[model samples]
Target: MKKGFRFLLKTIMWFMVITFAFVVLFKWVPVPVTPLMVIRYFEQDSEKRTFWKHDWESIDNISKNLQLAVICSEDQNFLNHNGFDIEAIEKAFEYNKKGKRVRGGSTISQQTAKNVFLWPQRSWLRKGLETYFTFLIEVIWSKERIMEVYLNSIEMGKGVYGAEAAAQYWFKKPAARLTQYEAAAIAAVLPSPQRYKASPASPYIQGRKAWIVKQMHFYGPFSYDKK
Candidate 1:
């Protein structure tokens, strides 16, 4: 019994050490690729499985419009939240319990944690780890760093990832040059990136984009002053 308990405890300690190291490393290093990027590659048809696009642009290089647009559309209280938004989670729980269209009240920090470290799946195990990583990143990385990683890592289209690639693919421009409508269009499709196009906008996307733009205006004069 002593031997078994010692092995389990040592295993857990090693895991914690390794995960903490990675979290601290990412605070200063650009994420080259994410688990989702690899997972999505294999999930596609064999002929197209190799297709992938991602470009890491500094947060300063990505347009402020895209940054604020995502904040308005995905997480209104992103700047204030630690890792989770209790009110949003409660609302999601209530809505899901009612059997309406399922909703996730994940804050930007939570989403960033999942996108960077965890696989894209719905499970209690993944959710638990997601919570763990979210807390780590929130504690270790600044808000600007969090947003920078998010803008540079999320899957924005079928094969495209990050604001830089998404801007070039959808708008034929760099991320730094995206206009407000262009930014909102990209943000609007984030919920279902594979099914939506930022350009040649669908009516549904157009409507969502308009709403996001309005929210961005109400969000008002956004800036991320790195400290």
Candidate 2:
């Protein structure tokens, strides 16, 4: 029993050490494997797709509309929550019970943690890792950093990652100049961007855009600076 306990402790310590190392390394390194980058590599060969890479300083950076739209669509109480929002989780559970796959309680921080560091899958183990990383990022990163990473890493289309890519692809403009409607359209397809095109012409896309616009007004502003 003593030996077994020692082995488990050592294993956990090693895992923590490795995780911390990667976190520090990636903080300085531009991660090469964004969702859209990976998809583009496989879908149409990486050479064909134009992957927009911009740091936070680009004037056409992610607009306030884009940020607010994401908050409104993903987590209304993102500013108030810690790593997890229990009330939103419970509400999501109740909503799902009613035959509606209409809710996810993930805050911007949690979403950024998953998008930047984890893979796409639904498993208890993956979710556990997500929670762990979510906690780590929330503790280590500011709310602005979380929002910036989320905007930069989210999958906007098959070969599109980040606001700049999506903006250029969909609206033929830069990300910083995206209108509320354009931002809403981008945020609306976030749930299944690979499947749903981010254009305003499709009926379902247009309806989703409108719904998100309504939600934006309902949720109001997210003040990350305050909390």
| Number of the top lDDT candidate | 1
lDDT of 1 by residue, 136-190 (tens): 9999999999999999999899989999999999999999999999999999999
After superposition, candidate 2 runs with Cα above 4 Å error: 1-7, 25-29, 35-60, 100-102, 218-222
Instruction: Indicate which candidate wins on TM-score.
Output: 1
lDDT of 2: 0.77
- Clashing residue pairs in all predictions, respectively, total 0, 1
Put down candidate 2 lDDT per residue, 1-227, tens digits, no spaces.
Answer: 99999999999999888877766665555555655455445666557765444333232367889988888888777787887889888988888889646677677777777787776766788789889888887777667767777787778876678888788888999889989999999998998887988885479889988988999888776667766
- Ten contiguous residues with the weakest lDDT in model 1: 218-227
Off by over 4 Å in 1: 225-227
Cα RMSD (Å) per model? 1.4, 3.3
